[model samples]
Target: MSLGKSRLWGVVARGMAMGAADVVPGVSGGTIAFITGIYQELLDSISRVGPHALTVLRRHGPLVAWQYINGSFLLSLFTGILISVVSLARLIGYLLDTYPVVVWGFFFGLVLASVIPILRRVPRWNTGAVIYLILGVLVAIGVSELRPAQVPATPLTLFLSGGLAICAMILPGISGSFILLMIGIYPHVLTAVHELQLVKLLSFAAGAVTGLMLFSRLLSWLMHHYVARTLAFLGGILLGSLKIIWPWKLPSDEVAAMGDKMAPLMSNTSPWTFAEVTGESSYLLAAGAAALMAVLIVLAVDFWGHRRGAHH
Candidate 1:
């Protein structure tokens, strides 16, 4: 299971893409993994971080355990993810503030484009899967509707936020940053990253690792045993999140320091009515172009992946 250097580098590149997506509040890194055809493999790799891997390590030594658990791939991927997050967090935060529509519009397209390929992969499609999909949609919408909490950002809170956010990050439709935003921890966490607060960052990382180790197993298990229903639910999540990523929004009074003009609360509005209501340029064409590009990019990736698979 050892990979060539080029293959490891490819994993790193994919991890960077996932990390970039996770930085956005309305985007999931899992979306990148899914669209790129590595979603199950990623889950399997993460799920290997427990007893079986350790037992192998003790019995067969480092190399055997490493290969057995896909350790090289996971290590390279997570290394790239960490590097990307550390380096790009500030830039992404700025984009979210300054070009909200364009950023969200592009990701909206990414998520939308991802739905078909993912849904098609379901092992069995039936009425029950449809019901679960609808249910997932409802739950996601409900989540989107809830107001951001004004909770205090204590150490314990940050730990919990890290755990919850990491769990969300791995789920196809849930955005970890959005979970942080919902709990009023997004800004605080961003501040830590921007300021290079080692203690806070380390604590969050520990929590993230714990959450990933636990939740990824559940996700992997579902993929193996109940893939149809899981895909339907995840697809529904992507569908429902469209509300969050809608291009036009009316801002609420809440403000945060991280955003130069960040509005805390926003409600989606029709594109036609956006400029009239907000008295700002709708940037409809720009957003539409971005959306188009997003769709094209996803299709291209999928097509290329299939081609590569065939070549193999």
Candidate 2:
């Protein structure tokens, strides 16, 4: 394919992968972007909607702001994520209920598999990187243990939450919805989305746009000026999040209602211990292992292809 065509397909694939990840709670689309070698570009694209965007909007008009929006990239990626979330929400919810173990097992495998590429990306193995990795792992474990809370779902709060959560969504090792959950806003935000509440959605979108622009610029700066340390830090965060994303577990004592759905408020137990030995556990483990292996293989192939192109 031509370069343009190849790039087009690449974006499309990325969108689809991101959408798929967003459909799952623990997994992140940002991780997928990183593994696919588009992390920096993705960040840069978001950063493009910087202060200059607002400046243009004020000096010129909405059209100028529109111009600043990197429509192609944002549309492709977000469309993918939106499609996945909308289409798979019920399916994923069902799976999580009926076959929770297997689903989580697969996610565990994915996170485990991701460590390889993240580690390989480090230009050098050093004490700093090791420390960062450990720190990241610890943070992820800590976040996993946090309890979910309920918050009033007002416009302002929803807007702010959306902004922050969306920023997290774009960053590997961060889960936007999980962040929402932490802020006691996940249920409301999700409810708004499910009900197609345009006002709430738009408010949230505004926050997301603002946050993405500001955060992306900061991320780009860090990546350009402190590539190793930044990536190392992100790698560590990804590692830490493994605890959050690990599949398999006991039911929570706390639950919250969002319309008809009853969601778990916190994880009071770990996935390793089970009440009993069952075929479900075995099936989930195998499935999780398989999914993780698949991601690893795909990443390896992409890396090899990149290397070949560079050589030629």
Candidate 3:
């Protein structure tokens, strides 16, 4: 059955949260989905929209096919994501450019709280799981350290970038926009969204649909067969992503001389030493407040999830 009336709004809100997270460089909408308890449902629904969906649509009426695909839930969720991306992307982009520390601090808390749910999913703890966690963290941290490489914004590049970035966006640890940024096309995509460039946006959307169809199957299979290993590995990835959202950074080459000579280059710095390193205001109080709010919001969502589970 499709989601009930009472739960529909919640799913949309979660999708909005995911979209908001995805717009940020260090945040993943998948992390928001996992934390809000819709991750598996999303994968299941997306995985169904392949040959099986076509067969169902042809054999059964539109109603039956829609129910089989959980169309209402997907529709509600993606609607929210789409609204947020189109409506909020520009504002968020402004915030990130202007108030980097505060933005990261808020996201840092959101991600930090996500770890609790991810870790609890580990069915049993053992040496293997621990090793997996470490490996994930190392991989995430290593990926976080890579510098962005400028790439062309041609139609082919945009299509491939969308496909590749969507794959990472669905992972709890990686941010798809961050992937785009790393590939040097993030600014281009963001501009397209902000400017209503139909051709570029359509190309990106086509790529995303293709990638989602392929990745959802693999992800659903992994979840079904290797639950513990998958969760543990994801936990590690989330843990390691902490390095990416450190909330402090050294100057880019534009501000001061850096060997790479980039305009927005940054290196992570400790909060305590941020002032000393950047010779600028750190806004520690604001950062702390934002982080606190994020933690509280996450805990509230967790409580709501438990209540829903009990009701079911």
Clashing pairs in 2: 102-284, 104-247, 106-288, 136-236, 137-240, 140-240
lDDT of 2 by residue, 1-312 (tens): 123656666677777887777777777888888777778877877787667778888998976576566556666666776777778788888987887767766666666666677777777778887787787777777777766666677789878887888877876777887887776777777678789998988888889888877888898998898777677878888888876865545557777554457766544244345535332344545665666676676578557646865897
Q: Any idea how many clashes model 1 has?
A: 0
Question: TM-score for model 3?
Answer: 0.90
lDDT of each: 0.85, 0.73, 0.85
- Deviating ranges (above 4 Å) for candidate 3: 154-156, 190-202, 252-262
1 or 2, greater by TM-score: 1
Off by over 4 Å in 1: 191-203, 253-263
Clashing pairs in 1: none
**Cα lDDT tens digits for candidate 1, 127-158:** 99999899888877887887767767677777
Candidate 3 residue-wise lDDT at 74 = 95
